[model samples]
Target: MNTKTLVSICSPVYNGEDHIEDCIKGVLTQTYENFEYIIVDNASTDNTPSIIEKYRKKDSRIRVYRNEKTVCMDDNFNICAGYCSDNSKWIKYALADDYLFPDCVEKMVKVGEMDEQIGIVSAYRIAGRYVTSMGLPIEQNVFNGAEILKQQILLKLHVADGSPNTVMYKKSVFFEFNGFNSKYNQSDVELVFKLLDKYKFGFVHYVLTKSGRDKKGGFYYLVKHGFHILEYLDFGYKNLSNYKSISFDKDEMDYLKMYYARAIVSFLITKCAYFEWEDIKRMLGNIPEDIKKEVKKTFVRDFPKHIIKYFVSLLRRIKSYLRDKKRFEQFT
Candidate 1:
């Protein structure tokens, strides 16, 4: 095993006592041995730090750092990556709640080493019970960045857009984009799109990681409160316009514009109660002016029909409850 390439494996954690050990063990057990495991504790008020220290004393490769105070997830992630050794050529993120298979690093590095132009390497991941990061051709090992971006925008491919657990990035390219943006909740997805705009994309057709779906995580909170729709709209509107390489014809762009507008209006009509008025306004404010106007117009036109449908559905639910009650009464 000639470990020529040094990978900086990073994990940023806060109050992750429940699963941090599993994450640490997964990294320590990697089949590929030449790597530095960097763990940055975000001032966790739990057993997380002690658990990390326990491992740190056992393995010389494990380096631990702690923030004086907790910071935003994206900011902490950036800080973790910043601690990578200068000699490292690649950066791999094993999130605190997620774990990778034994051969995960070996397979990903193999693809990455195949070409210097390949800046991002992705593979299938078991998210809960199902495998994801699909839609790449089985026979193809690499793709042009612009073409991959086009496929992602058109909803034809999903290999390039996944959580940190599913991908490995070139250390230089990761820093070139200045790491994840702190403002957006889906900064990992945003970074992938940005990377694909410049460098080549590589794929490994095997499931190499398992992503834990923590219901208490920020992503789950947003989706549970129906705020993910707005965040996604903001992410798409901001990044999709910057890629001049991914050209969309007039009709396609028009369809996508209306598609976004309708999505917003639908969310407003159905899930408005989940959000505060001020929050709704703030989220909508980030959207482009033209799309905001289209959302308003779509809301005005569709509000009545959606209300009618909602009342009808509510009435049906009431009727079903009444029927069940009547049956119980007869049995009594």
Candidate 2:
């Protein structure tokens, strides 16, 4: 391997004892060997630190750093990304719970090398199967940045398809936006919107990663750092007028508002189901009354959809539980 273009692979960990080793191995075993692996531990109390040390001793290319105290997830992510070497031109951010295919870097870099204007290269990711296949076939590998942003704003792009785990970006582009913004729970989506405001994004029609939703730090983490519906609505509201390259007409803007309102109500119902009233109320504080009214209205209209999805999710969980119980029985 020529390994001419140096890529920086960054992963941030906190109490990820179970998944950190496999995550490290996924990076170390990459077929493209010219990359530096940077791992940041956010003062984890678990065995994560030792697991990282064990790998650090074996791989000279691996560099490990520790934060004195735990920081926000976005801050930890920025710290990991900042450790890239001066010579490194590209960065691949791998989440601690995710696994990367061996050819991920090779494939992404190849597409990135096709054009200097290409700021990000993304590949398909598997959660259950091509999760981003939004009932439409993709016909092109390269898309105009403004167009993609427009699709995203219009709710045509699947959010999972735009996750950082399946994407790689140029080092310059990451810094140009000052790394990820911590305000939005969907920080990755905000970054995508900002990047697409100026640069082109390419796609590789291959599944190069598997997304893991386990080990999400449980309930307290959800209350502290989880995605809130209002945050997303606020993001959509705040950024609607900020795009320089793409402009939405009046009708389009109205449609987007309705779209966001529907999403807000769906999430509100979900939060009400799981969280206490006080937590949900605190998250919704300072949000305008008009928005709340719209959410209430949409909740009434969309209540059945929410009920259907809840039942579907419950049934899936039951099936998974039974399957696990059967496997345990067999093993015993």
Candidate 3:
């Protein structure tokens, strides 16, 4: 792996004063040195700009820009993608709240370089205390892009690993697809599906990134921004089936129905718990009537276990809170 292919690390941040420095440092200290770091401050009214400058002055490879007007998450991400250097062949998103391990870029690039067809390279991530699930086990090291798209449609890959920040993609693929879709706030997952339709994916078995989540901000932001989980599922189901490259068999369609059923039910419960009826009504108003009916049907079908799991999840959160409080007290 002596080749020095230029990699562009882009981070689109808003009010990220708390973690922006660490994110920039993670990029600066990457074991792979031939890279450029771009940080887009989306009118952040915090110390984010200054912190970015603190490192920018020290490193010639770092570039910082501030947007005149704020933008949505997807738009912000698009801006980040637009900042990639023309010579950069690879684009890696380093979210402001996430930290990358020293060799993350090196290993991911290694996998991508293994084959000219590899469009995206991703690794297992160590999620902080707040992740809901790690997703279904992908036992293989390299996956056919189309097959992984099928897996995603079947909801077998339904968990946090689909994050764009955890993966590196070929710059050509990003541009060819016109980057992430802005219509869906959860555009990252959609982008992955589209990319997989055309290119192969390389999986690094090691955990190379540390991802963090906020318990409250997670659901609130999506719901407020009109990103319903049901829409994501419905969009994915339709998008994958209609995708010209991938064809699903009868067996796969059956499994897809089962997965969609479970997914709808799970989504309903989470949304119901986190949002008020008014908020759900306002945000979900555009959802089709048939999809709404299916949501109800699935909720009724899974009511018993849904209740049990809801309580169990609540208890787990309480336990986690207590454990964290005790750890903090120890430091005090």
Over 4 Å off in model 1, which ranges? 224-227, 238-241, 273-276, 300-332
Highest-lDDT candidate = 1
Task: Please count the clashing residue pairs in each candidate, in the order shown.
Answer: 0, 0, 0
lDDT of 3 by residue, 171-206 (tens): 998889998888776677777877888888888777
Cα lDDT for residue 104, candidate 2: 94
lDDT (10s digit) by residue, model 2, range 195-217: 88799877777788877544353
TM-score of 2: 0.82
The reply for model 3, stretches above 4 Å from the true place, is 1-3, 130-140, 158-161, 219-228, 265-275, 279-332
Per-model lDDT:
0.86, 0.79, 0.78
Worst 10 residues of 1 by lDDT: 273-282
Q: Rank the candidates by TM-score, best first.
A: 1, 2, 3
